[model samples]
Target: MMTPATIDPLHTPLCDLLGCEVPVLLAGMGGVARWELAAAVAEAGGYATLGMVREDPALIESEVTALRAATDRPFAVNLIPSATDPALLEAQIRCCLDLGIGAFSFFWDVMPEVIARVKQAGCLVLHQVGTRQAAAEAEQAGVDVLIVQGVEAGGHVHGREAGLDLAVGVHAVSRLPVVIAGGISTGDDLAAALRAGLDGVQCGTAFLATGESFAHDYHKTRVTAATGDDTVLTDVFVLNWPKGAAVRVIGNSVTDALDGRLFGHDPATLPRDAIAWDGDAPRLRFSTDSPLRTTTGDMEAMALFAGQGAGRINDIPPAGVRLRDMAEAARRILAQG
Candidate 1:
């Protein structure tokens, strides 16, 4: 058998490693992950992370400032090295260092020099990997933690297998503490993963429905209303975003129009049925939304990122409340066993 794990919220290997009360962590959702949400998650006893790519240097600094202004607890900054420009990534890392960021979660494989620099600066590094080979390489590079991302994850996914499959597969090869991402919405999922040998769980979509998230109300409302079947994985946003990574989004007019084809449509050919108002003006689009608070289109028709476990999420509460509920439920379930 594998190592025994817990979701007690008092201390797991993850909690002891990261100095957080709970093993649950907020997934760094890029543009969707803002300072408000990050601070609240950290304050709620789970580890939080600032999504450190996508935006420019100034914006990242500002968000770090915002996060600091809100919470004194430790948090992380996540970067996708494969998708981020190297120079920008370096600058962002430097800025984070100056800002006193103690924890960082990196997407993609870890580079030796980069990991060296971050570690030298006294930051603990968590590398997210999609395969066993990548996990082995990360451990070789001295990654303090491993985040196993599966295809069922919302936002961007790197693994061909689902979360549980990858956790088990990677566990067989490496002994690194594993935290799973993808379709983790409830306590049952957390309990199952821990019992199967994962050290922790990082949930994105269910947390997106929490009050502190910067997502528009329309988007949050829709997530609470959705079931697992409502999410679909696609690379349709390649023009303005990364090219090949699978982004799991809720089904809407845009996804329906694409019909599972990635690059067959002209932008002009999209239907303008979904509408939202700006004072006296009406905005229309099939989908150009990243689901920000500023999004003013029919959000259901926009790119609403969600995982398959979204079906189990039924309410919108504070981040702390959600964390407590999941932890309590997991503790109870683990107690029975």
Candidate 2:
């Protein structure tokens, strides 16, 4: 039998990054992060991240206000340099400074100037990278933390050549604290990540089933029903946006139709055929849509975003309950070591 280790809340660097009791961060997702969800994670003794690129600066201000009102616990805001408008990013930074936001998560080749600005503003700067070189540069640039995203993640995968091995990234560099993401859906995985020398695990797919998540009922149901084979990565979704970052989404008619068409077609000329429903309906699509829809019960068309670890998730529950269980399980697993 495997031996258990003691729970050491203060031993990990992730706890220092977010000022939380533990290093379990709820990874940010555009259009899926909500104030209630973020606050619930913080309340449950885990860090929460609010996505920055999905909305305007003023909306972010409103979200910050709502989040602040809900909980005084520290939380993070994830920003993508490639996707966010420059002016809007500056404004968001200014607002975060004004509100005293605890931490900032950045990715996609951030400028040195932006890094300096955020540092000067008294916010903890966290960089997301897929390569060992990026992690070294983040350390050189003076970032406070490093989030290493793997191939099995739900959204844009970085390191196609390096693969989604968390051990590679964690052991690749010793200069900074590494936080591993992608396919982290269970306490066993979390324990393994910690043993691999990672500071913590950032999980997006695991939290989708939480009640406070902004995921639609159909989306949540699909995620609940998914297996390891349910997800696929392709550039079919965000072709309209620049770089057209590859995303892993659950298999559906939309992904099925575009199967091999992504290589040849001009993304601009692609026809929009899916009905965009906005009012009162349970299903909805944002501007950054790919026409793929997930089904729930009788519903056939709704978007379901899931990571390759979809097989690990089996049910939906409140955010607090799930997080509590994960932390307890991880603590127990660690104690066995």
Candidate 3:
């Protein structure tokens, strides 16, 4: 068991429940939140989550192994059930359970059976919800925690409400501990969330700009240079995901070209032109694939996911260092009150 250091003014029930010293959580950004970043956040006394959406079982096992090797601290593996095929989701969960992963974080839709299955195997479940209905359902499905994601969140957004309002609404109705997501990039954001009675804050665009993140350097640079106005929530990048799934990304050529026609488009009918590549696999235009460290070819045209918080992040520091700095800053702010 990793003993958490006493972090004054920042520690909350979430810290104790997740076995971390701080209430900050690294958002499980698919492709971005790999083993290295997750391990760094966990080692830095913040809860970490490895994004394993629609991944092969072998890859999941390898990433989990790498994380465990890096630190004994508890972490969760994030999975999106609504996006993943049922069979693949089952395989992913089984692989995680077999690897003895202690916790699981889910997003998009609530799958009661999946939650119950992981709970049966003695793993904690954290579900990110965008609406009060989803939060209530997740609580009823036995999730240990709720992540209320506001529409301001980057990548795939499930709710239309703002982060704080959604979190407060969920907290009022649900018995589960709640963490707020979306547009949370700074220490002030973290402090405000806690002060608003939310348990913690989960950050994506902030952490995506960190050194350990698997996002391409271009993506990190774009995020660091961007302002809140630079991000646009659109359904333009819809391939591989269900129709109507909107994602917030840095505005680029693709978004510019499809400005007037961002929604109600069918992914199946879209041209399969290879705008980028990850190894030998061709990434199609309008696909949900973002620029990862291994991605190449017209990187700017790819989905550059960032939240409004992208404006707040100015540097690409080490993941552990950035997380600690955020926690310390939040502590200082909280102490003033």
Candidate 4:
């Protein structure tokens, strides 16, 4: 239940458009975001996004059903146009539409074919970009919303500039509603972005430590313990996945073992599902990655992607609790201004 103290119910143009009380959205973190996490955020009045990095047609259909069963609030999902088979992607989109999902976000190219399809089904399309040029292109490509990513983000980041710079540059050229991503963690962060003229903010690392998040306990602790400078962007972990994709993560044994040897390596050489230890917990093979709710092991050495603002994290609370607090606080700050 929403209380006066926790739910601010502040309205914005984007909020009006999405029918949400808060002007924040959860980043569709690949392998990390799932039904429970998405449900909690949506229940808290923020947009919840399910990541599609581990998705297949069947999986997406089932997951969409699961998410809808949990919440009547609006929800969204991520799509990587180049990551999967074309036939499978089309099927997944059709399934989502049939199951009542009305929004889709793409990582690149503004996703035209999908934009046309989803629009026919009465869905909203959001496209993310790291540059002003791409923002213009996405707007021209007919994306309903523009999410500008900055370099401070964790995981597969694409921004060449910081949040303010990217948002400013993109906003200067495009009239689309802009959602700034990367390095956002607090009410003040969202407030600052809104004050600077961005419509909303999408966050990845901030939700990692939430109780509904699938990240391992170790992953959450490491994020809270980390400083802003502790994160580094590298393609060492990309291996067989997205070749040379730069992911931001805190350094540990696995990262240190690689030590600048980033490219031209076969990830198959690494132990496929190898079992290692972070202390007493059993960690899996250092090869590929996914954040399982049942996560255990030397998870710090695994692919625990996080942004520079991880330094701001200090607790693992429910998504609704954390998001409500952030929304209320941001509304207060924005009201002050």
Most TM-score-accurate candidate = 3
Q: Estimate, for each residue in 77-196, the C-alpha lDDT of model 4 and write its tens digit.
A: 888776556787777777777777778888855566767888788888888888787788788877888999999987777765887888977887787889999989999898898888
Q: How close is candidate 3 to the true structure, as a TM-score?
A: 0.97
lDDT of 1 by residue, 1-337 (tens): 4345532433678888887888888988776678999988888889998776656779888998989899888888887766767788778888888888888888865577788789899899988888877888888988898889888887766777877998888877776788988899888888888888888999899889999888787778888998889988876543333445567778887688776684444444445554665445444553334566765646565567888888998899998888889888888888888
**Residues 223-317, candidate 3, lDDT per residue (tens digit)?**
99999899998987999998889999999999899856777878878788998899999998999999999998999999999998888899999
Ranking by TM-score: 3, 4, 1, 2
Writing each residue's lDDT as its tens digit, candidate 2 over 249-314 gives 887776677755643434566555444543333333212442222322323433457888889888
Q: Global lDDT of each model?
A: 0.78, 0.72, 0.91, 0.78
Listed in order, each prediction's TM-score against the native is 0.87, 0.87, 0.97, 0.88
lDDT for model 1, on a 0 to 1 scale? 0.78
Q: Tell me the RMSD of model 2 versus the true structure.
A: 4.3
Write the candidate numbers in order of decreasing lDDT. Answer: 3, 1, 4, 2
Model 4 weakest 10-residue run by lDDT? 274-283
